[model samples]
Target: MKIDKGISLTKVELDRIEANFLAAWTGDNSTPFIVDAPISASLRTRGTAIVRQTNLYTLFQLCPTLATWAVLTPLAIDYGASNKNVYSHISVFTNKNFDDAQAREKLKERFRFAARRIGLPVVGNQPTELFFAPLGPARSQLPDMARAFVGAALHLGPPAVEDTPSARDWQRRAVATRCPNLTRLNATISFDRSAYCARRFEAWRRGNEPLTEAEALLFAAYDQAVIGFGRHRSDLVAPPRLFWNGFTLALEAEPSQSAQSIKLGPFPTQLPGGSQVAIRTPWPEKITWTAGSIAQDIEVAPASDEILVFDADSGVLLTRTALETKVIAVASERQVVIASEQFGVTSFGPSIQSADPGRFIAWTITGDELNFPGRLPPWDHITSRDGALDQCRLDRPRRNAYSFGVGWRVDPQNRSRCRRPNQNSPRTIR
Candidate 1:
């Protein structure tokens, strides 16, 4: 329980260490198993069940096939009088019976240890991502993320558009306000390690040394098929809400109420290949989307809500502080202007330099925080340019400063201290 100060680790770090160990040796997402959703519904998989190749115990004599080595394995075991938390039931369904009120309630939610390899799921690298869901790869994003008057016109400069998440699943926190009906289902089962194997792991835990390949050969890979039923729950009845269809918008099933503002934002939305997304709302509702600057009451039913759809526009949003004025630079005879990539957004350029389009004196910058770091009170500026990147003509812009608006939180807490970002951030004519 108590380790040397030097080796003591935070809970997250300790879990990470165990996860790495599991991934290196036991991260086999291919093992076959089954689980019950409700008491009546069962889920199964395809793979070779883990079984011992050789039998050395008396079970073979008593009943050759009926009492296989797997049958004899204990669910858990202990040695000393006190072995507090030696074996963890991490992410396993402790209560497998859904019919029992208490058991189902207990099964309602169980934390998954970061070491998912200990459980029997072939999870990919990111444990945060779930393998099973009703949806497939999302081709869209949420829409209009600016914390300020997002659905309305600019309060300061332009609409602040932030970075977005894949439309596969909405973030739980952001979706909470929309009051969407959410159903959760968990499966109960632990098919990776046996009680004796866990006891061995307890011993290994002290030494902090992994088993040698030859040492590992002595252990047997085991499996079981006694997964019981888990649990499920639905959200409380609430206001009508809109669901991201991964490409557009759809109304959730709810008793229709007239004149409701179905907020479609707080998440930035986008479509693949930069195609326009047509928002489809439920038919027969008098919809009114009103913000400070723009209020549109459009009732386009049995049809996509193109003009009224919050996520409909795919144009790059300039920040509220963005300049209303415009600056145009014309490139000719191999001379060019440029826009560089930032914040995962792709970009192109008129090259003072050239990959293939030829070269000229590249458009210059005063400063770049990311690509080029500046010094002395950190004055960011372009000293020279072999080729040019757009948007660099201003700030000596370190990427942090460049990203200040649009997606960044930009110190909202300090809004009272400094309201509008007083910067010379400029955009090029794309």
Candidate 2:
């Protein structure tokens, strides 16, 4: 069999090759001597069992030099089962007790030279490094002989050469080729829609181009909905106010030049078993009040420009002040009386029980009467108009003090009349 150019195996070498093949096939573990024969022919004769045994040692022994063995190992394995045992054995045995760094450098040089000999591109410094050691998993590197064979078969083509352009450069080129008019200048890539619009607006401003119809609509909608008209103005015509009603007016108060300083009197004496309390101005404005508590019914009476909160039973004054304020009187088992000028109040306490949960009344007097300047509806005839109110028109006496018509009325004919079940008895309204 022809092993290389101008080299032919004699009868003795072919006999030795067949003997090693039969020995390995019969499971002989003895180290078989090498024979000068084509690895392909030996593989066909012995099958994959050649590499699974010590037959690879026979092939390496027969080869003239490591270079020849390197170029033929992969070919033999490819013709066999492509099992890694042969390659692994080659790596360990050849490099045993050898300097790893020096051996690696030599193998790399030889592999590159052999690849170039086969018309492969040997570009850049250490181009062999791509397929050599450290590129794949550790211990993946085969012996010098095995690497030379596999490298030639696997990487001996133009496709194996590393291309010059980066992935980003190729992607940009592809986009430009597909859409020639697309410009990336001053463009911002963002996941946020607001940021995208802002970037688009800035780009349009820098380019000095008229806004597209879609861009104009986007800007107008964003400005009117998210950014109020007072703070931001869009270049496009303002969007029509679809829900604007004349009754809903936006009122902006003028900033006060100076805040009024309110002086408060001493707190009223605490009741027995009362808890210690601390009160401070709810706002940054300098205002103080006399902290106090009261039991029994409390009455808030407005006199001229001043307001007074006093106990109705004893007629003792609790607070006398003039300010837009709110009063909260807790009439539960434990009473907590608080009067504050703050617009909002937050309270905490144990849940209270009531026979009629909806009968409880808490009123807020904001000093402004909410008036609809129009003729009022006839609430007495509401049952005739709305079927839902028919059940409420029973002739029986109203048991709930909070039932309709007690504190509400409709002056449909510009006349008001109080309705009481027993007006002659002089019932007191609480």
Top lDDT model: 2
Per-residue CA lDDT of model 1 for 232-347, tens digit only, reads 01111122233223333344322212222333455423222212334542232334443223333323221211111122132221111211111111111111121121111112
What do the candidate models score in CA lDDT, each in turn?
0.22, 0.25
Q: In model 2, where is the ten-residue run with the lowest total lDDT?
A: 237-246
Candidate 1 colliding pairs, count? 26
List residue ranges in candidate 2 displaced over 4 A.
Answer: 1-41, 44-90, 93-98, 124-430
How displaced is residue 239 in candidate 1, in Å?
Answer: 24
The residue-by-residue lDDT of candidate 2 on 1-430, one tens digit each, is 4443345555575456544443332222111111112234545444333323332334334422223233333422331234433334335433322236675455445545543332222333342232221111111211221222122212210010011111122223322343333222111111111122223333332334323333343334433432332322222211011110111101111122212111323543221211212212121111131112101111122223232232333323333333222121211222111222111211222222222221111112222111111222233322212222111111111221111112221111222344542422321111
Q: Which lDDT value does model 1 have at 247? A: 35
Error of 2 at 410 (Å): 99
Worst 10 residues of 1 by lDDT: 39-48
Cα lDDT for residue 37, model 1?
10
